[model samples]
Target: MTTGPSQQATFAGMPTPLYSGSPSRLLAWLDCPRRYRMQYLDRPRPAARAQRAHTSVGIATHNALRDFWDLPLAQRTPAGVAELVRSSWIDVGFRDPEQSAAWRLRVRDAVTDYLRRSDRERQPVGVERSVSLKTEQIAITGRVDRLDDRDGELVVVDYKTGRQVPTDDDARTSLPLALYAVASARMFRRACHRVELHHVPSGTVAVHEHTDDSLSRKVAEAESIAADLRRADAEFAQVGVESPRFEPRPSAICGWCDFRAHCPEGQRMGPEKSDWAGLEPAGYESAAAGTALP
Candidate 1:
């Protein structure tokens, strides 16, 4: 006798479990099911690669920005920002101390310039705010970098320190941003349709406004993904690593995949990138630090 994913619950006479995870988990499944299984389902999850230079820089920059908001009104200055950057800096994955130090200074200046246009007097409603969304199919949680009350409505702001500058289309198509906006609106009881991608390096701000209809569509999209994930998780529960559903999706992204060492299929796609490769001018493989799975 064979059991299907949805029917597996019937064998134990228990209701199907609702998939509970962050938006990242859902996206991970989409990025590559094999990698997703290794990351989330494998017993004693396979070790990922060492942190790359760009990830370190991205983390430091995000930390500095996060801490900057916590400072006293008077402490919000260029000097204070620089000190935050220095304190938050991670010395890992660099070519050497010289390269690390130089990037540290570059990050400092970029953050300072990014902050200059802000209204320092007005504190944000939430910095690194955790938000969650629940549907009948799934429960998703994630943290928003910044949340602001502009006029009576809330705005979702995500910082980008990567080589790729976000565009209005990026904001419009982003599942996470739309989900964040929906969660914020529900939590604060205010309209939150506007989302912004703030690129710290070039000081470029990409904006998008979501309507109720558009947000509904995004929610539907999430629900669909979750439905697929529920089945995948069920299949994994039965077969473990032998499940045929987890197939490697090889692409250029394989070069930067953290789990490349364990995935021969992905490894064949390209040579593994060096730890410092992401720090180069053309190194756009990784997204923001601590965010991208690959």
Candidate 2:
């Protein structure tokens, strides 16, 4: 006897299992169901294009930041950061070698400047830390850029290298950041209610202090997202790409999406951006960091 799309997962007697993945996965599903299907459901996942220049920059910066704390306390200086950036640099998706090289130097300086204001000697509670939280319906996991124990309180820090310099409102309502804080608190047996978005290029930090009520709301929000994902996932399991639930959500950022190539709706929305379109603004570099790209 065959099963229907929703009922195919169980033996009709046992309890359903928890859904587990990084927070990015949940966000991806929420962001666009078609992209999510391509990214996570396809039997042979479609090949995504090579990383764009901005993503390359983000990755290099994140790697350098993650590796910084591994260096000796004496070597965790501006020079050290420069060295890390240079060594971790990814030369990809740039217009040419010259452009790639120029951005490399610019990113190195940005990292150096950002590190100058940081107390490099103080060891972080966790760097590039993997934390997870579970509820009856879902299990969410993600890696944090940095976890700080400031005066015995835990703080979640996420590094952003994109053109968007995070605002305080960005910190206050970030689902991933809130989930990370809650997971860190649970894993470390400490209270963690503060989340921060650290824009590396501009040396700007956006912070939000969460109360118990707010945290509960965020968790509930995640649960709601997960519920939608759960139903869609079940449908995908049975119908594959033919599932009606897996449809595209077109928006301005569709051009930036990794799976946009497979989406006709996305293609009609606008011309695709060049791989290197996000690396600079029209006139000044630093001032335009957060101006153009989404």
Candidate 3:
């Protein structure tokens, strides 16, 4: 008597899981593992002020310079770039009107300073170009701010929005710039050994020389990070959301954390949520609605 398979229950019935990856995920891991868990793993909704005014101003400056470089050679003048900045102006997270105005002036001055220091005579070989580098198990993607081929040698140029000028060691250790050099070399079919950090605010250049060994090391580090992410995702799938507890690292910088109010560690540190003064109404309206008024 051939009997068809009887109805039997599967062992520990559970649905499959979901996982996603992004460049910012790796960056968060580098910053703090618990922070990374809260951000990427838990994916909590923010209920507090996230970023500082300086960060906003820096982003605006970087975007302005990027747009300026995107312009045609005829429009590469300082005046043209300033106009671009004004056109693309965003006032999302400023403390107050006065602070916003001061930041705008600072951005304009930085752009002007950058243009003056940059070589107008020599046009960029490439600008705002996106490239990707891949290994057997990892892929790293980013945009190059500027790529210049001077005197038959390739150079990677990155604009710095911070007030302080970085030193040569800082430039050497910068992962993004090194990655750009590696990607640009592969894209252009040339050797890119020189990486530069152009500090617009200080109008100075921090140069670093890269060797094949160093570039290989950076790639290996990135691959290792990717492997860590894969392992984390696998563990999450097996154990579910309750698998790993999300811990928060509270510091003075917690005031700038987007998930500060949601973080137990952050709340226990001090000053629950009184740091939103002078911020734009639009930026804090949601946060205010989520948390009680102070």
Candidate 4:
């Protein structure tokens, strides 16, 4: 039997598939390829550690803020925010019920103060709205905490509950924020160049304005990361867990990594952080907003 064309040759000319992921996924690969593989590619997916107290606080605050916009305009008061926080509270990862209750009240007060600065009567263009961006090389998706229309221009707002008060540099350097801006602009068919990091705990707002060149640079950076991920993912498909591309990058972050239990190298870096440790002053990082994957 004579074959017209070999199967290998038939498929050899096909272009590599575009990588599909959220901004968080691209960052995961950069943070630790092994963790990314385990989190996203592992068929039986390793179980992550329990949520930390800070994450609970962040999620609850985000939830309350999201629901706050849904309330009747007259009910968007301090009392309403207090009630929302109470209802949205996640009572987990705390040392005890007393600690949880205390933090709950703290979050309530902080969120109330944060919203006080906003024009409650003017509804935001989007609240926790999901947005996406696509290029020839990759597809990225993420959710924006808030989207604002100021002077006919769209702005991306990301809420931060961490102790690290964001700065203009933080806003400018954030890959997720930049991606959200690009996605929001393309989705709404409007110009979006401004991004803000709102530190809800302290009610501090950090802003950055991106130029066309800057936004393009960010997209290129994402494409570069996605290209690397695509190769790693393909290698995983061929050899599974034995793929050499998935290597651990141990650092101080390993202490707080959710998959520390599963990564021997990460476990060796230091003692894993206690579930409630994040609520401690020393444990604060910029991760209080939680992961922004779709």
Give the candidates in order of lDDT, highest first: 1, 4, 2, 3
Note each model's CA RMSD in angstroms.
Answer: 5.9, 4.7, 11.1, 6.5
Where does candidate 3 stray beyond 4 Å?
A: 1-23, 43-51, 70-75, 249-252, 268-294
Residues 189-281, candidate 1: write the lDDT tens digits: 899999999988878899999999999999899989888887787788788878888999998889999899999999899789888887637
- Kindly list the per-residue Cα lDDT of model 4 for residues 1-294, writing each as its tens digit: 111110112255576455678889989988999999889989799998888999999999999999999999888877788889999999989999998987887887777767777888778999999998989887788899999999999999999987678999999999999999999999999999999999887778999999989999999999999878877876787789898999999999999998888999999998988888777362222222222111
Residue pairs whose backbone atoms clash in candidate 1: none
| lDDT, candidates in the order shown | 0.85, 0.84, 0.66, 0.84
lDDT of 4 at 252: 92
| Residue 220 Cα positional deviation in candidate 4, in Å, after optimal superposition | 0.2
Error of 4 at 270 (Å): 1.1
Name the better of 1 and 3 by lDDT: 1
Q: What lDDT tens digits, residue by residue, belong to model 2 across residues 224-291?
A: 88888878877787778888898799998888888778889999889888999887553223442222
Stretches > 4 Å off in candidate 4: 1-15, 280-294
Q: What's the lDDT for candidate 4? A: 0.84
Per-residue CA lDDT of model 3 for 1-294, tens digit only, reads 111111122244432222234456666767655666666655353444556666666677778876775677776665676677677666766767776776576567567656765666576787777877766666667877788997787899887765456889988987878778888888888999899988766667899999999999977777677777766655654564564533455676565566665677766666643332423332211111112111
- TM-scores for all candidates? 0.91, 0.92, 0.76, 0.91
Steric overlap count per candidate:
0, 0, 1, 0
Best candidate according to lDDT: 1
Cand. 4 TM to true fold: 0.91
The residue-level lDDT of candidate 4 at 63 comes to 99
